[model samples]
Target: MVVERRSLIIDEREAASWIRDGMTIAIGGFINSSHPMAIVRQIIRRGVRDLTVIGPASGGLDLDLLIGAGCVRKLVTAYMGGEHYCPVAPMFRAAVERGELQVWECDEGMYYCALRAAAQRLPFTPWKAGIGTSFPDVNPEIKVFTDPIKGEPLLAVPAIRPDIALIYAAHADPYGNVQHIGTGFGDRALWRAADRTIVQVERIIPNEEVRKNPLATSLYGVDAIVRAPYGSHPFAAPGYYIEDAAHLREYVAAATAYAKHGDRGPFEAYLRKYVLEPETHADYLEVIGIKRLISLHEY
Candidate 1:
């Protein structure tokens, strides 16, 4: 039987409520590109706990935002930029070291493996990855075993069936259906790997936009849609417009500082003022006043 998909539309704050403690979530992004930061910040401000974030080459302003708020319990990703193994955003490191968080070394096939496992309703997948290397040292959760298919030794990773998936798209409709001209990756992988999915789009365009693409998401796949401006903060880099270098630097500094303080209060303050309390990301930026944040680092 083909399962039917449900649909919903919600605002940013309402969308964030889908996140909760100890739930794994697949986030959309590729390093410092095309991230869903405004939503990430709100997830921080709202104080969801013990989150495991899986992304492509993550670790930057968006990551700092989550770690500083103590929301991230573990991170399965390719890289953590700006600090090695964690100096700026050391919470993930600390958590893992202290046995509070499980650090999983991730890579390209990670997206495919996780989704496949979930779609097939299986347990940790067994496949050879990072063999004869330190992946085992970094992530003990990946059990080394023989492949049922290949008839050889392989690594098995528990299918990453996240409780929810947080993603962003170029545009969406009132019914929560989405279309991406470009910049959307792992949408199907994330959706299939999670229990529910929430999207924050730059605009709510007409539903007909999907007809043009024909391969765009169906109403059944989306759980909620949120209209967000500058949704891909810091990382999106805005085509020709300026990026938020100043804010990103400040966030990195704050995360490193939080590592020393061992508290989430400061990062929460940053998110509340710059992301959650405001009606929109622009509203937060306006109230914060870009000119003021630029001088933040000099301090």
Candidate 2:
């Protein structure tokens, strides 16, 4: 008897279709590194709306762009600022200040606890991190309960089960085995908390290559796999390229102008140039050009 090999490969557009309105989504990446920018841009282009977004522990423009594009109705995150590029993401700050976005405030520990609870299929996880903090004060969802064993106050971090997860990996086989070179930065936990996962990888390696170092396989049985070269463009991919600081500055400047002066001209112009007009991933990449991309490549 002969058996056919499994393949979960799909294109960026098809990957975006997996998401629906009002569903919660978990994005994987740290600050501006290894984000699935190609898939994100496609989702924006598809005009998906009313999304409840769960940003990474440390996120930047990836979340901001979604908010600015009017895709997110609610945001659950601990931080939404660029690490060193721009303290606060301009669009994210503007939306929150204008009362256009609903925020589910969580500290880092509380945020991770929620995901952990979901991953373990628990109702809620007991945490002491938010014991004396203002987290429960602002976000009533975090309930304060007495610990049964320790007889101490603890916060019940409700499970944050996402409908789907969008993650980036350095390599994945056709069978949906994902591998990463360096730290996955909470991506492992994030995917586990979701009902389904779509991974955007730089390369679709052979199954044999993935088995060569099985220990490096970060995730298995991914629902979908998209081969997106320079998928994290403008953001750094661990061992692939450095961030395009100049491009990031350009975006920050436009968004800041909109936030500071209500000048939508620059910000809208940016969306038109980068996100809206690009019909495909290749087109978006062409806008970045070869020379500039080559300059950012470290290896």
Candidate 3:
């Protein structure tokens, strides 16, 4: 008998190619942290459209960029904003206001239940929190049901099954063992809910290093691994660097200008500068400049 081991390592472009139009895709990262921006940009560059995006609990540009680029047809998430910088994502608001996009309303608890239901291969998960609220009215999919065993009313949360999931992590091995320095949040659950998972990491460590701390390994059997140093650029990656506040402010300003005055120049210019023109991840880093990248860590 002969044994051979295969590596899951792939480049960013290839990872982006795994996605197709009309697929339900999930993005990992809570708010502006640990987002796989490199792969997200590549997806935009590839011109993949009509996607149903399942956003993280608190998503920012990772979801906004897709919506702004017309890649996403529907968004599913609890919130979309830049945290303290911006209350609501400008492009997302504009799209919703103009009837250009569809939103699947869900709160944090409902969102978790949906993903959990999918991960557990269950039809639906019943929750008591939304029974008395306006959740059923707002989201028609949520139904008030009576639990047979408990004989109590509960909201039935449906499963959110994504075709693919994109995640960013601190370290991973070629064998697809992933590790995150800080909190994984709902990311692991998102992984289990999706059919396939693609991860971009700051470093590709040795299998021995990964084996040293098996408990630290956040995920296993990831479908693809892309080595992307500072991969979560403009966002924070635990154990690596912090968010780029100046760049975020620049994005917010451009997006806000577009939303307020319908001025496409500033917003289009941003897309061209950071997204369209960057043929590769290295080019994006160059456009971000060495000084700016260094400052993220110092500040």
Candidate 4:
């Protein structure tokens, strides 16, 4: 078989353009950490609407920002909140409570299983997690059937196949091979499940360097790669920087103010300051300030 190689390097704006209206988009991260926030910001700035957003167990600023910007039509996830019980995701909670957003809730296992089914090209996966529970009651589409041999009912979860998936990585090559540090969470599965996968990396290393340690290259099937330092800002990228706790607190406060007082001022101001004003990811970093960013470095 002749190997085909494609140039995967792209800018943030181009990466955002890959997304269109009414697409099922999967974003990779756990809670607030390792999210592709830079690309998420670009997506918001472009004003893409009617997206069905999916993630693993939890999402923090990344998910909240998209929802707050009125980009999401539906959310399918296990949870959406801050890390370590810091604060509930104000925008997500507000939308759900007001019944403005359609939500499909599931446990982490069910969500992962659904993705796995999609990766394997299966119609659905069977699990016992939600059988005879309130999950089926809430999500009536989840079907249960009796196991032939075990004589026990198993829940059937439909495959979660996104039109595209966005993930952040510590390093990547021009060919789209990605290297992730720490627990990769559901990134690998998310990439495989999506029809297209885009990765935002801190930097691109030489292919030889990526080949030296094969174990670190856990990601495949990546469709595009963009070099994005501090791509996961406000969310920790292991070995690169610590989470910007102060900024996250500010975001939580802004969202809370908007939800409680019907004040869109703070949130809108945040959008202007972070997403709208910045022409590029470098511009966003400048707005974040060099001193603060330097302080966040793990080294």
User: Could you say which candidate leads in TM-score?
Assistant: 2
Residue-wise C-alpha lDDT for candidate 3, range 9-123, written one tens digit per residue: 9999999999999999999998889999999999999999999999997778778888988899999999999888799999999999999999889899999899999999998
Candidate models: Cα lDDT each:
0.65, 0.91, 0.91, 0.87
User: What TM-score does candidate 2 reach?
Assistant: 0.98
Pairs clashing in candidate 3?
none
| TM-score for each candidate, following the candidate numbering | 0.78, 0.98, 0.97, 0.96
- How far residue 229's Cα lies from its native spot in candidate 1, in Å, is 1.5
lDDT of 3 at 20: 94
Error of 3 at 204 (Å): 0.3
**What is the per-residue lDDT of model 1 for residues 130-188, given as tens digits with 9 covering 90 to 100?**
66766666677666776767778777766877777787776777666777645455566
Query: Which segments of candidate 1 are over 4 A away from where they belong?
Result: 1-7, 57-59, 82-100, 148-151, 216-220, 237-242, 258-272, 275-282, 288-299
Candidate 4 C-alpha lDDT tens digits along 1-299:
89876778999899999999999999998887899888899999899999999976666668988999999999888888886535678898888888888887788888887898999999888999877788877876577878888999998888989999999989999998899999888888789899999999998998999889988898965889989898899899988999998898888888888878888899999989988999899999999998999899775
Better of 3 and 4 by TM-score: 3
Question: For all the candidates, what are their Cα RMSDs to the real structure?
Answer: 5.5, 1.0, 1.2, 2.1
What TM-score does model 4 achieve against the real structure? 0.96
Model 2 misses residue 85 by how many Å? 1.5
Order of quality (TM-score): 2, 3, 4, 1
Local error of candidate 1 at residue 41 (angstroms): 2.2
Please report, as a residue range, the 10-residue window in candidate 4 with the lowest summed lDDT: 79-88
Model 2 CA lDDT for position 131 = 82
